[model samples]
Target: MKIPIAIVGCGGMGGRHLLGLKELASSDMNNITLSAVCDLRRDNAEHLADDAEELLGSRPLVFDDMKRMAEAMPDLQAVDITTDARAHHLVASTALDLGLHVLCEKPLALTIRGCNRILTAQKRSGKYLSVAENYRRDPMSRLTKALLDAGSIGRPELFMDISASSGNQIIITPWRHKKNMGGMLLDGGVHNADMMLYYLGDIDQVYARIALWEKTRYRPEGDGAVSGFYQRWFGEMPESIEATAEDTLTAVVNFNNGTMGQWTQSYAAHGRGFGHKVIYGSAGSLRPGGTRNGAPPVLAHDGQDEITGSPLLDLVPDFHLDAITSNLFGADRLASYDIPFPAADRKLLAIELYELAACVLNGTSPEVDGFVGRRAEALCYAAFESSVLNRPVSLDEIESEQVGSYEAEINEELKL
Candidate 1:
């Protein structure tokens, strides 16, 4: 039987999920039935409903409230929670209470406690719950992990990610600049942090310095643009609002393997936007973010030292590192896993939808469960604490409730 599903929050991310569902239904995958699309704005919901009509020859029920939608579609087995990070817990908990499996967007919630609430609700309901961490499920990410397993870069020693932005705020949802949404890290950097975990495993410790270098006052978006990322998505605000969340963050992540990684995120940066996920290993180094530059996604170091300029060779673009026996070994290490082609973000969402259905039909656990999502969120919080406290904060310290930041504000925002 086809899984009855709903797409909540018909915004940018939600639209992506909608298209993904279209792909599944159009392809005769029959994996999901687009039972509904819910958004705060009636137009957004109706728009996607029309798009579904065009694509699947059927329109889903439109809703502005999730609880009412759940009550209307009692048979809905799943819901894709692409609402704002701040409202994820509210929508997800409501869906869980309705006995619907949930596929929520990244960070799960603005605060770890919010994530815990959803997690607790999921446990009580005994239903499937997954976080839409597409970065971890992306093809490039999979290739990078396979290469790491293949030891193309032996014993990872150092890692770095520099995500500098130009006109970044133009794409940002205004609420992201506030304390409740955790400013930059929770709003966007969760993807970066989650990718780090995907590559390096769990973080052992974190020492971070977060700051708002540019006090550029941006008024809340009014009548959002329609063609760009920020289009038709940002929440409406009264007027001239100032944000308190940090706009820039520099963090040092210590992985359990004794390797250290440096991460820098800035939404206010300009002049030659730069970003790449580079890992320096004992034998060689590899850069996986090259696909953005139209270069091979997987490149191995040709020299002994990572610091020195070394020509990257054996661009195992297909992730078949073992096939190139002349250059490196251990391709078989990743053989246990499949290497899908690099797909669009929307395609990744579609893939997640299939997985969510599988979890219910096969009686399985979600790949990125709530606990995993919460930990990633905690790392973001730990960064905030490190900055506010002006010292390194251990993940355990934050997880054990020994430390916390923005909890009161997040509680107020979510009315916890």
Candidate 2:
């Protein structure tokens, strides 16, 4: 029997998760089904249903309200949440209390208070909750992790993650640029921070600084005067927009393992080659993609010549919907394409579904659990704190609170 899954939020990322689930459903590794979907917009929910039906030969129930949907569908085994960061805690807390396994999107939540709330809910309910910190699942990043674990990069002393994109020009959506919805650091760098924790272990403290370069711009919707990156990207030029949220953040983090590292996440930079992570160790250093200026990305004990070549780009998997091919028809072609396939999130989503189905049928814990998710969330907050205070902030300094009552209330709402 297929483990029934529900989804909340049917936007770009949510749609990608649905597509990935469709591919997983076709595979024999697991029997899974998208039984229900919810979005703030009814049309978006229906669109997801229609897409699932066309792609997977099954149509899921669509609803505008996730709470109402969960109430009506008690049989749902799990819920995949891809809403904005602000709603992550609310939706995930609700789902977990209802005894539904939750696979939530990253950052977990914008504030530590909210994260604690979700954590409390998980503890009280004992329901599975996992954050979709997908960058760790990226083939290149995973390979880097393998090298680090294998001691190929023996005892990493310094780690640098420089992630800059061409800006969110493609993302005309208003929520992404909003500070309350989690802005860039929370929205984008959370994955990088999670990946760091995955490789380097827990962070003890962090110190950081942040900046927003572009001040003003015309709104994409032609509205007047917005703030921060949204204003720069959408409002008028030369108008100084107050960046209540950090757009450029650089931080030094102290890990419990005694390893020290620096991370820089910036949206102000305009460049083509931006995303890269390099680890310097006692033995060898591995950098994703090859090095700049024709240098090798990975440097080893024996020097650069000893560096092994990267995994063939063609062999990388595509777990998301590409512009040209469907996952069903593109299976064989995945080997032919030279480009690195699927964004990191899609790959993680696929792996997550596989594990989720197994856990449901066999009754085991997920590979990544609520504790792991919380740890990742902590690192991100530490970075934010460090950046804000301009000094290292210890994890112990941060208070830990539970959301058991909050989740219980939500569960009652669901009649769970």
| Candidate 2, run of 10 with poorest lDDT | 289-298
Worst 10 residues of 1 by lDDT: 321-330
Stretches > 4 Å off in candidate 1: 167-169, 217-230, 233-241, 290-295, 302-343
Tell me each candidate's TM-score.
0.85, 0.79
Error of 2 at 324 (Å): 24
- All candidates: CA RMSD in angstroms? 5.7, 7.5
The count of residue-pair clashes in candidate 2 stands at 12
Q: Model 1 misses residue 381 by how many Å?
A: 1.1
lDDT of 1 by residue, 71-106 (tens): 887788889888888888888999899888999988
Name the lDDT value of residue 260 in candidate 2. 82
TM accuracy, model 2: 0.79
